[model samples]
Target: MQDLVNLKVISLFHSENLVRIPELSSATKLELINLAYCRKLLELPSSLQHLEKLTHLNLRWCKNLRFLPSLYKATSLTTLILSDCSNLFSFPEVSPNVRELQLEGTAIEEIPSSVESLCQLISLSMEDCARLKNLPTSICNLRSLEVLSLNYSPNITTFPEMSRNITELNLQATAIEEVPSSIECLSNLCVLNLARCRRLKSVSTSIHKLKSLRGFYLRDCSRLEIFPEILDTLERLRNLDLSGTALKELPSSMENLIGLRQLRLENCESLVCLPESFHKLKSLWFLYVYGCKNLVIWPDNLFSAIGGASLTGRVEMQKDLHGLSSLKELDLSGTNLENLPTTIKQLTRLQKLILWKCERLKSLPELPPSLIHLDAHDCTSLAEVSSITKLFEQALLCKDKPYTPKTLACLFTNCFLLDQKVVASPGTPKLQMLFGHMFTILKDYHQASPQRNMFTTCFPGSEIPEWFDFKSSGSSINIQLPSEWYYNRHSMENFPGFVVSAVVSFQDYFDDAHFHIRCECHLKSCNGDCPNLSCSFTVWSRRGLHGSRLLGSDHLFLLYHNELVRRFVETQASNKCIYKEASFEFYPGVWERNWSQCISCEVKHCGVHLLSAATDDAEVQPPKRYKYVS
Candidate 1:
């Protein structure tokens, strides 16, 4: 090793009891040295300064290391890390060319004023420096310094003025009681994070002058009770977070942040009211207020201004909404809201509305037709579900522009009945309309694409619809296809146009469970031999808001496989005397493992629709062996 004077890189990490480094006095070309996690390493040889070309050094986690020697002459050094050296109390003068420096988790008491000599310093972090008292005022003179982080330095009472060139600052978990008015001096600062600064009682109103500020994070500042009143001048401000704070109310100035897009106030339990000026925020898109338990009243008169026809028949109606047309998402989960304003139905472009765990909410006004997702899970107090059905009707009937359609996804898990007083009266009518809309949707789709299978699901009742050609009490049913059935075609080409329907009741719910229902078309010869053709249809189940239910759906599948029809026809032409009837078998299954417990939801009804323009109502024919008991 003594003869290897041109060595450029050396790593000797995780070595135990390596108290003294071997002599390397002659290695002048050394540019990097790493001895990280050398737990027992006591010191670096002073001869390290002989490496005139050294540019990087890493001694991170060298627990027993006491101090570092000066590197004032190592002009090429650009990266230096002396982190987690608990026993080390001070860092020597770093080279001016160094661009990044980290001294986290150390006992360093103060940053030296000489740090200003590093004209090229771009970042300086003293995170978790428990003994740090203050930052040197001269640090503001480093024209090139762009980032300064003093997180977890609890003893730091006063944050000093920083360089105008600094674009971001982090003082999280510090003891600063107030941000001094000098904050205005940082004209170029774009990001400022004072999160968890419990001692920070107030912010200077002059901070609104930071024209370039685009992001501000004040999360979990427990003692912060108010915001500055000069938001009107923050034209460039786009994001602000006051989550987990102690704010009792939001200032009217907040509504003046026209360019702001997101505002977070989660866990601000003490907040009592929101100002009516919120309607003026035209560009505000996302508003999160999940845990504000005391916030009961939103801006009054929030309906007429947004053009939402508010008909608060029983509840007093006011009008505060002025220009909230651009607002897209709003969350009011875990609040004390009892009813939604009728104006909510006016947000034409809003896509998502979340009201999870709103225990006092009893009903909702008409929802905007543009809604795509509604998360109303655990809203047990929600009673009126008629509004939801009307919402669906409105969305489906985007009648003005018939060709353009909208899709909506909703979740109502563990929901309460819309009108629990009269189960049959309320449920029956709504269920009928829901099923009716579904049928229209399917019929319209069929008109659009005649050959594609039209499928739909509904939980209206256990009894199959009167339209099904066959209804059964058990799991299996057989349909006999008559030879003349094909000869009598609805088409000139002698092709039969038919669709299959089925009804099933779900016994249990599974997150990713599958149900397999297969149709087998088979013929048993006079010799006791059987030849059959089959096809299968699968149903994947997801967790439902309500418990398991029996479903009736229009199915297009397995029963109409061309192979079965062709084989039946071929067999028909060859031997018409063997048997006049072909056996059509329907079998329902859940993966064998879950089949035993899921036997209750059998295919209660099965049938086929033979189409004809003159046949306004396809007559349902009773099976030959089955008895039709009314």
Candidate 2:
């Protein structure tokens, strides 16, 4: 210990034990002490403060250390580290030179105002101190303090004069409701985070002029209504989010934000419409509108006006919408729409369609042949399966049952609709099966039998079918497509499901390659029937002449009779799936100018597990039948 003093080392902390400075006041040479991560040592000697040269001390991560010494006399100390000192509760007073201090994860609640005496301090990090509720007002005097991170400090609601020289600030998940307008005085400010400040309603109006700010966040302020006008002044802004706000419209001046490259409006449900001028965002590469349920329509010229830009990702719209022919992916299941527009055929790039719980839709229009995915679950009103069969080249059937007779018939007729198979797909085997199924449906099930009518006897509210006498207590109405059994050659569109209904049986010795059967049906009421009355029985037709090389059989079959098939195939193959992935990558940086846009963004993702394999094996002795190689 005598040798330690002669070396001019005032404080020597080796692990847990603090080697005492026996002649510390007399020597006057020792200036610092460090006993960081010392698990075995506990307390410091009270007499050590006499060594006036002692200026630096470190007792960080010492789990067992408890009490601190009185340092009112040692005025030269300049730095202290007590981070993760779990048992530490209080500390002694010292010189104002203590400019750098870290007490993170300690039991300290309120910092003494005397700390403000540290006039030369530059940085202070007190993160993760759950019991810490307030800061000393004296801290405002530290004019040199530039960095302060109170992230996850739920109890802090305000700061005093903290703007002058500080460049970075994070108050994520804090209780701050309003930022004082004086904040605009932060001339050098760059990054700010107020994510999940649920109670924050408005920002200081002068915030728009923070010319030095490059990044800003205001995500999930649920009740926030108006967007601050400060965005107009941020010429360098690159990203913005207003996902979960209550605000319904974007300011017309937003078009002037020329530097913005990413924008998010994920769940602003009150947003019923968008400004037509939004298409003028020439630099925008990504946009999101996933769950704005009340959003009824988009600008009619949305694509044409902005179509030249490289648009990518999920451009979400609410259900029941048939427009947006340029959108690559669509989700329309939760709404109350009965059908999609026939114009949907114009989208030649759609990849996925999700129609879940659309209970009112009884039939689907013909879909784009480009479709690779389709999900129609819980559509309880759907009785005939023919309408949805042509939509997907690959089907994900949720309800487990064999195809109904109607479905088989539609599949047989629409078999010719299959286009070129993807090169990566398995060869010939799937093609053969499709052709064989079509032949079986035409040869064996072509007989028009009313026995198939038993499936549709009861309607909603349990109304009996016409086949049964409703008055008889025991008579039950068989659910069937009510058959007129009597019709003239001219009018056939009067019945529901007429496009797929069995119109006529084969005449004996079928000679003419083409035959037409016209019918007129009469019913007391056309309930649960076609939405349009002028439907006609035009035979299915395909583009160009049907070549025998496309099929093994010499028979020629028409592809799709209704316009639905053409529309479905075109959109299903377009940009929908590809753009959804692009949107995910665009979200991180879009908070520069439009930080309020991502207030309500909630993404709906559907994942499908197409195949699962199970294997079982047992250990076995090798067979001796084969001769060993010599």
Candidate 3:
């Protein structure tokens, strides 16, 4: 130590064998010392008090360390961290100049009254201090403190008094039963998190005084039955989550939060309905009410009020369901909704609507043209869907204009009622015409941008379509390609691609289960002059088919793969090699650890159809050498 007088920093981080540090008194110029993760170290050298220039010291993860020497004499110290010192029972006196102190994961039972001496402290964290029971009131004297976190302290039953300058306070997973009205003193607070506080019952109405607050989280407060009313407009509040609570209704004044952008009420089973004034939150773009089974009614003018559209009578209720123009996603899964308003199509910007397991919903109205994804899996009572022929007719009307393809996906797994109705009315244009119209739309989109267009659909079925050029009983199929099969010779109006289909069945039921169908392709040239070309693509299911139980039933899965196949063939054209044979293998893939148990999808049948611009009908017949591997 005497030879290192010029040392400005000393770091023995992660030195597991280190038990003691040599006296640092000789290193008078040292400004920082770190001995984090030194598990065997019991105590720091007392000579540390002599370093007047020492400004930072970190002893994090020193599990065996029991006590820290007072740092009162180190006047220059501004940051001190003793986090995860499991054996440490007492708080060490720190210099008043210290700006940050962390004692998280420690054995300290309480903060002493002397803590007021840290008048310059700006941040203090005591999270995961399970033995800690309370904080002294003198802590409010820390006028410079801006952040305080006591999360995961199970024994804490009361909120501590905080300074007026505080900005963020987190008390998650605590035993606190109520938020004291004194919380109003934190006029500058920006965030308040009380999530998972199972014992919490009520919040002070004075919470409205926090005019600067931007986020409030009370999620999983299972015992909480009431929320404080916002006596005044909380214009700055942007996010509020009350999920997994027992609340039955929201105060009508909730509409006063004009800037609110996201609201989550998931799993609030007791919630019956929203206040009539809820429609006034025009800025809200995301609203989730999943699993609120008792929720049955919606304000007649909910959507129209938000969009400033005109409202009409009951006969016109379905006609006036306009507005909510800024909303992009709406989830009403596991609810009691009986039917959707007809004019819901007026929401010109909505992109996704999830209604999984809404068993009471009997039918659907016309959907908005902007919708790109729709999931109605396991909707047993859903017997009719508004005519999709109208949508196709509109597309046909606009065929002369420059095409701009929109990606689309629709899932209807286990929709027995709807499938039974469609099967009974085989001549019905609703479901029967869908395949032809969808194919036409796909062709038009592919002709415009072969590399960017995609379409996917899943519905109840037991066999592959007869139009597919090559068919196989199992999962793999092989076919031969004629020379120049990649392009059409007659005109450049169509682009080359493949339409792949499969009939798959699930062996069992699993919650939140999902799997992807992986297609691995191998292409080889006739003369073996070019190297083998291999590529793969996946067809993913949306939202893990929530609540899906498709046991003993088969579903038809179809999708278009133009980008990969077209790009590969164009690159091969430059090689002047004739690719004559191609083989495709299909298998199920599970990517999530929890979903690994859901790998029971059996591919019963598979088929492939090739599209070429040179062919007048756009369908290329399979060569005589076609082979099938069962």
- The candidate that wins on lDDT is 3
Model 2 Cα lDDT, one tens digit per residue, 288-360 = 5545555555555452111111123223332222333334455554434444554454455455554544454
lDDT of 1 by residue, 1-630 (tens): 477588999888888767878677888889999888888998787777666899889888988989787777778888888888888888667678888887888789888888889999998888888998898889989999998888998998897788889999989999989988889889999999999999889999879888889899899999999988875567777889998899988888877687888888888988866777777777878888877777655676455321111134223334644456876787777765667767777787687787767766776778887775676655767766556656654544555443343444454434434323354555454334443344444334323322322122223244543334444554444544444433222232233333444555444533234455666655554445556756455443333322333333222211223223433445443343343334455676666555433453556655543332232232322223433322
lDDT of 3 by residue, 382-430 (tens): 7776445344333333332343444556677777665552444565433
Q: Order the candidates by lDDT, highest first.
A: 3, 1, 2
Candidate 2 residues lying further than 4 Å off, grouped into runs, are 5-41, 45-60, 70-79, 90-95, 239-247, 255-258, 261-630
Error of 1 at 502 (Å): 16
Using TM-score as the measure, the top candidate is: 3
Consecutive 10-residue window with the lowest summed lDDT within model 3: 305-314
- Whole-model Cα lDDT per candidate? 0.65, 0.46, 0.74
Which pairs of residues collide in model 1? 301-318, 301-319, 301-320, 302-320, 302-321, 413-545, 414-545
- Higher-ranked by TM-score: 1 or 2: 1
Report RMSD (Å) for each prediction in the order shown. Answer: 10.2, 23.8, 5.4
Point out the higher-scoring one by lDDT: 1 or 2.
1
